[model samples]
Target: MPRVGLFIPCYIDQFYPDVGLATLEVLEQHGCEVDYPAAQTCCGQPMANTGCTDAAVPLAERMINVFAPYDYVVAPSGSCVAMVREHYTDLLPLTNKLQEFQAKTFELCEFLTDVLKVDSISGSFPYKVGVHQSCHGLRELRLARSSETVGDDFDKARQLLKSLDGISFAELTRTDECCGFGGTFAVHEEAVSCMMGRDRLADHRAAGTEVLTAGDMSCLMHLNGLNQRHAQPFPVMHIAQILAGRQPEGITPVNSTDGSVA
Candidate 1:
C-alpha cells in the first residue's frame, strides 16, 4: 500500500466535510495508508485566481511542507490539485522539493485510475446523473478529452463512473461547458456568474437528470444555488460521495418550495 496524503480543500473541509470523509473512506477501502495533515488549509487558488500571488505564497509553502513527506498527495477537487500541479511552479521559486511535490499531487479520479489502477468501485447509484466537467479537471488535468479536441478521446471520470453497478449518465448537450464558478469570478461578476450557472443547470435539466455530480464542489455549489433559487428538481453531489456510496443529506429537492431534503 502506498503512503497517501489527503488534501481536503478549504471549502470542502468547512462547508462539505462529508465529501472529505467520503474521499478518505474510498482511499482507505483501496488499501492506502492515508494521512490527513490537520494543519492543512486553502491551496491559495482563490487568492491566486483573483490576482493576489503574494497572499497565496504562504499558503502554497504551507501545503508543500505538509504534503512533502508523503509518497502521494491526492485531493477530491481537481481545481485544488490543478493549483498545486500547474500553478505552484509559478507561485513558488523553482526548487527540487516543489517539483517533487507538484509531480506527486493528483486529482482523486486521476489518482484512482492512474496510480491505484482501479477499474471499478463497489459503490452504486441507480439515478441518472449529469456530469459537470469542471474547467480545471477537464482542461488542466486532462481528466477527459475536451469536446473541442479532435482525435482519440477518453474521460477518466466517466470511465470510473461506468464501473459502478447501476449508474447511468445523463446526456448533456454541452458536456464540457464551464459551470461559471471560477473561484472569485462568481463574486466579482455576480450577474454573469449567476447567468452562466443557470445556463449550465438548464443543460442538466434538459437531460432530465435526477442528480448533478462533478469533481469540484465549488462548481456544484454555484449550480445548486441557482437550481434551488429556481426550484429545480435535482441535487448537486460530489463524485467522491457517489463513488463512496454515500449520498449527501439535507439537500433540498428541486421542486420543494423550502430548502429541505425530500
Candidate 2:
C-alpha cells in the first residue's frame, strides 16, 4: 500500500465532511495508507481565485512543505487540485521543491485513474442523475478528451457510478461545460454565473435527473443555493460520496410549488 497525504479542501473540512470522509474511505479501502497532517490549510485557491496571488504564497509554501515527501498528495476537490497543478507556478518561481510538490500531487479522479489504475469499484448509487463537469476539472485537469473516440469513457464520477447496480447516467448535450462556480466568479459575476447554472439545470430538468452530481461540491453548492432560493430543488452530491455509496441520512426537502414556495 502506498502511503499518501490527504489534502481536504476547507469547504470539505467544514461543510461537507462526508466528502472528505468518503475520500478517506475510498483511498483506504483501496489499500492506500492515508494521513491528514494537522498543519494542512487551504490550498490558497480562495485568495488566488480572488486575484490575491501574493496572499496565497504562504499557504502554498505550507502545503508544499507539509506534503512534499509523501508518495502522493490527493485532494477530493478538483478546483483545489487545479490550483496546485496550474497556479502554483503563478505564485512563485519554479524551484525544485515546487516541481517536486507538483509532481506528487493529484486530483482525486486523476489519481484514481492514472496512479491506481482503478477501472471500477464495488459500490452503488441508485439515482438518476445529471453530471455537472466542473470548469476546473474539465478545463484545468484535462480529465476527458474531446475527440472522436467511439465508446464510453470513465471520468471520476461516471466511472465510480458504473459500480452501482441501478443508477443510470445521462449524457448531456454540453457534457463538459462549466457550472459557473469559478470560485470568486460566483460572487463577482452573479448574473452570468446564474445564467450558466440555469442553463445547466435546464438540461438536467429535461433529462428528469434526480440528482446533479459532480466532483466539486463548490459548484453543486452554488447551484443548489440558487435552486433553494428559487424554491427549485434537486440533490447535489460530491463524487466521493457517490463512490463511497453513502447518502445523507434522512429525507431531503423538495420544492412543491416551483419558485413560489419551498
Candidate 3:
C-alpha cells in the first residue's frame, strides 16, 4: 500500500469538511496508508490567480515541504492539484524539489483510475447525475475529453461513476463547458460569473438530472448557490461523496409541487 498524503483544500477544510472526510475514507478503503497534515492549508490558488505571487509563495513552500516526503499526494479538487502540478513551477525557483513535488501530486480520480488501475468502486449512487467539467480538471488534468478538442475521447469521472451500481448519467448538451467558478473570477466579476453559472445550470436542467457532481467543490459551491437562489431541484455534490457512498448532510430529494419526488 502506498503512503498517501491527503491534501484537503482550505475551502473544503473550513466549509465542506464532509468532502475531505469522504476522500480520506475512500482512499483508506482502497488499501492506502493515508495521512492528513492538519497544518495543511490553501495551495495559494486564490492569491496566485489574482496575480499575487508574493503572497502565494509561502503557501506553496509550506505545501511542498509538508507533502514532499509522502509516496503520493492526492487531492479531491482538480483545480488544487492543477495548482501544484502546473503553477508551482512559476511560484517557486526551478529545482529538483519543485519537480519532485509536482510529479507525485494527483487528483483523486486520476490517481484511482491511472495509478491504482481501479476499474470499479465498491459503492452505489442510485440517481441520475449531471457531470460538471471544471476547467482545470478537463484541460489541465485531462480527466475528460473537451468538446472543443477533436479526437477519440474518454472521461475519467464518467468512467468511475459508471462503475457504481444504479448510476445513470445525464446527457449534457455542452459536455465540457466551464461552470464559471474560476476561484477569484467569481468575486471579481460577479455578473459574468453568475451568468455562466446560470447557463451551466440550464444545461443540467435540460438533462433532467437529480444531482450535479463534479471534481471541484468550489465549482459546486458556486453552482449550488445559484440553484438555491433560483429554487432549482437538483443538489450539487463532489464525486468523492458519491463514490464514497456518503449522502451529503441536508440533501433531500427534490419534490414536486404535489410533494412527491420529482
Candidate 4:
C-alpha cells in the first residue's frame, strides 16, 4: 500500500467538508494509507490565479513542507492539483520544493485511473446526473482524454458513480468544457462568466438532469447559485459525495442503506 497525503483545498475544506470526507473514505477503501495534514491549504490557487506569485510563495512553501516526505500528494480538486503540478513550479521559481511536490501530487481522478487502475468502486449512488468538467480537471489535467483509450475511458467520477446499485446518469452534450466558474475570473468577468454558466445550465436542463456533478465545488457553486437565482429545479453535487454512497435531500453519512434504492 502506498502512503498517501490528502490535500483538501481551502474552499473545499471550509464550505464542502463532505467532499474531503468522501475522498478519505474512498481512498481508505481502496487500500491507500491516507493521512490528512491539517496544515495543508489553498495550494495557492487564488494567488496564482490572480498572478500574484509573490503572495503564493509562502503557501507553496507550507504545503511542500507538510507533504514533502509522502509518497503521493492527492487532492479531489483538479485546479489545485494542477496548480501544484503545472503552475507552482513556474510561480515559485526560487524553491525546488514546489517542483518536487508537484511531481508527487496527483489529482484524485488521475490517481484513480492511472495509478490505482480502479475498474470500479465499492460505493454507489442512484440518481440522474450530468457531469460538469471543471476546466482545469478536464483540459489542464487531460483527465478525460479520448486519445488514451486503453482502459474503460473511465473518468474517476463516472467510474465511481457506476459502482452504485441503481444510479442512472444522463450524459451532457458537451462532455468537457468550462463551467464558467474560473475561480476569481467569475467575479472579474461577471457577464461573460454568467453567460457561459447559462449555456452550461441550458445543456443540463435539456438533459433533464436532476443533479449536476463535478470534481470542483467552485464550478458546482457557480452552477448551483445560478440554478437558485433563476429558480431552476435541478441541483449540483461533488462526485466524491456521490461515489461515497451519500445521497442528497438530507441524507447524512449515518444512514445505512442497501438494495436497489432508486
Q: What lDDT does each candidate get?
A: 0.87, 0.80, 0.88, 0.78
Q: How accurate is candidate 1 locally (lDDT)?
A: 0.87
lDDT, candidate 4, equals 0.78
Over the stretch 6-61, how does candidate 1's per-residue lDDT look in tens digits?
Answer: 99998888899999999999899999999999888899999999899999999999
User: TM-score of every model?
Assistant: 0.93, 0.88, 0.93, 0.87
Candidate 2: give the clashing pairs: none
Better of 1 and 4 by lDDT: 1
Q: How many clashing residue pairs appear in each of the predictions shown?
A: 2, 0, 0, 0
Q: Sort the candidates on TM-score, descending order.
A: 3, 1, 2, 4
Worst 10 residues of 4 by lDDT: 250-259
lDDT per residue (tens digit) for residues 16-121 in model 3? 9999999998899888999998778789999999999999999999999998779999999999999999899898899998999999999999999999988898
Angstrom error at residue 86, model 4: 0.6
- What is the alpha-carbon lDDT for the whole of candidate 3? 0.88
Model 2 ranges off by over 4 Å: 146-154, 230-232, 248-262
Tens-place lDDT per residue, model 2, 1-262, is: 8989999999889998988989999899888999999889999999987888889999999999999668999998788988998999999789999988988898887888889988887854555668788878777787664434455564666766776665677668777767777888888999999999888887787777777778888988888877666555777788887777776333342433342312
Instruction: Kindly provide the TM-score of model 3 when superposed on the true structure, using C-alpha atoms.
Output: 0.93
RMSD of 4: 4.2
Clashes of 4: 0
Error of 2 at 21 (Å): 0.9
Candidate 4, residues 1-262: lDDT per residue as tens digits? 9999999988888888999999998888888999998777677889878888889889888888999879999998888888878877676664566667777899887787789888777644555678887778776787775432455564666765676665666777876657788989999999999999989998888876777788887888888888888754565778877777777773322222453424
Off by over 4 Å in 4: 94-97, 146-154, 250-262
